[model samples]
Target: MTVLRGRGVSLSAATEGGERAVSIDVEAYYRRYGPQVLRRCRFLLRDEEKAVDAMHDVFVQLLRYQGALKDAAPSSLLHRIATTVCLNRLRGAKRRPEDREDELVLQIASADDTESRTAARGLLDRLFGRVPASSQDIAVLHLVDGMTLEETAREVGLSVSGVRKRLRALTAVLQELELEAA
Candidate 1:
């Protein structure tokens, strides 16, 4: 087997469909996107340990989808994968007795105004819950995390205009919700 270096990882290239193809370099992926993934997990889970675990889980998942991921944009795809992983973990926590304690702790430790934070998180959950998963990722990356529009677009694999349009529509809906609440 021949070894190929990709950002400090060794990957063996293989032939598929009579074309030379490269495998996913887990280490390279980690080196490039690990901190960002960790941040996403931490932002959602609000627990240092769980965030680390979630980041690891996402990489493990990347291994399973390595072939398909070879053609993907690493950052955008990883961001989406991290979001899905964190969301799944959150959902799973709700169903597990042991994890429930951790969830409660995370909720409480997330902010001083626990009630307002919970309400805001709930509102976001409901708002993004009604949209496509990509939209949720965009909202979290842009509005919640305060990433610029260009950054959010690049991370989400959308054109700037496309992301702008989505944000505008999302803002309108949120404004309507605010009006109704008021």
Candidate 2:
């Protein structure tokens, strides 16, 4: 019996001296990794439906590239593929700036109490509106989504240092806004 390097499965040699590779159980693989892949894709794509499509595409790509993944860690491979798939989906698509603004507004509108929620929404709207569009996007991707600076850079097609600078600028603007509001 010979075991595949990273797949954690063993296969027996055939009578004719050929090693028969075990068939991939795609469903089991999906079941194990589906949620993780979906979460990563959703973080990158932001749209639930687009994230689902990207998840499916990632799985398909994984199946097609199974041979190459024989020696790679499955989780790392899945994350890398999911990130690439999401970035590809984002590349050709035109995102509506208003949609993102509305989404952020809605998130701010959902706080615990009605009065606080309204105040938060109003503050966020004013602050975000005053900031440059690029800064708003970076702020949302980094602060709201809890994405790392590297992930934000990947999503926004910015360098890590560029993202860091943008985030710092945004923070300064937010601080000024908070002081003015107070």
Candidate 3:
């Protein structure tokens, strides 16, 4: 008999010679990767509590897919999973009441005039709209999250040189937008 266990589910199957137990210890995996996963979620979500929740959600997903992902790279796989989970959350999200107040306060404090802030925001929106989602994700991981190029590349499944090239292209787009505005 072969006994398999994962995520509180267990099964026993017939084997030719002897009994074997294959168990996936999800707690161990969570302990190993929880912090890293949380960081990835925070980078994507920009909220600490939401990041923690997303990290837990990623672990739950790992439980569901652990069998198939046995041979996968843990960090990259978890990062990708966290990214997908965060993106999904963002997709159907509505602005929270407290967040609106916080945004208003931040905008008032940071901007000398409302017009420039609005212009800058519009420019940023246009720039982001022009970029591919993957490149945006890479930029956020490296730039916003302060991840190293190689680390971002690993998480994004890209070569370091490819990430660098995309960053350069992003910079060019910014420059073009600035010149057009001027």
* Best candidate (score: lDDT): 1
Model 2 lDDT per residue over 1-182, tens place = 54442343333334456645444444566887889999999999998998999999988997786654553366787899899999876764443122233344456646788898888878878777876788778877766776777888898999988886776665566668768978
Per-residue C-alpha lDDT of model 3 across residues 78-123, encoded as one tens digit per residue: 8889999999888735421112223433453366677978865786
Question: Which residue pairs in candidate 3 have backbone atoms (N, alpha carbon, C) closer than 3 angstroms, thus clashing?
Answer: none
The model with the greater lDDT, 1 or 2, is 1
Give the lDDT of residue 160 in candidate 2: 81
TM-score of each: 0.47, 0.42, 0.41
Root-mean-square deviation of every model: 14.5, 10.8, 13.0
Distance from true location, Cα of 18 in model 2, Å = 7.7
Least accurate stretch of 10 residues (summed lDDT) in model 2? Answer: 93-102
Question: How far off is residue 78 in model 3, in Å?
Answer: 1.0
**What TM-score does candidate 2 get on C-alpha atoms?**
0.42
For residue 5, give model 1's deviation from the true position in Å: 4.9
Question: Which segments of candidate 3 are over 4 A away from where they belong?
Answer: 1-23, 94-182
Colliding pairs, model 2:
none
**Would you list the rank order by TM-score, best first?**
1, 2, 3
Q: Model 1, range 1-182, lDDT digits (tens) per residue?
A: 46667554555665655665568778788988999999999999999999999999999998888866664578888888999999998987664323232333354346668687888677666666666778768766765566877898999999978886776666666656667779
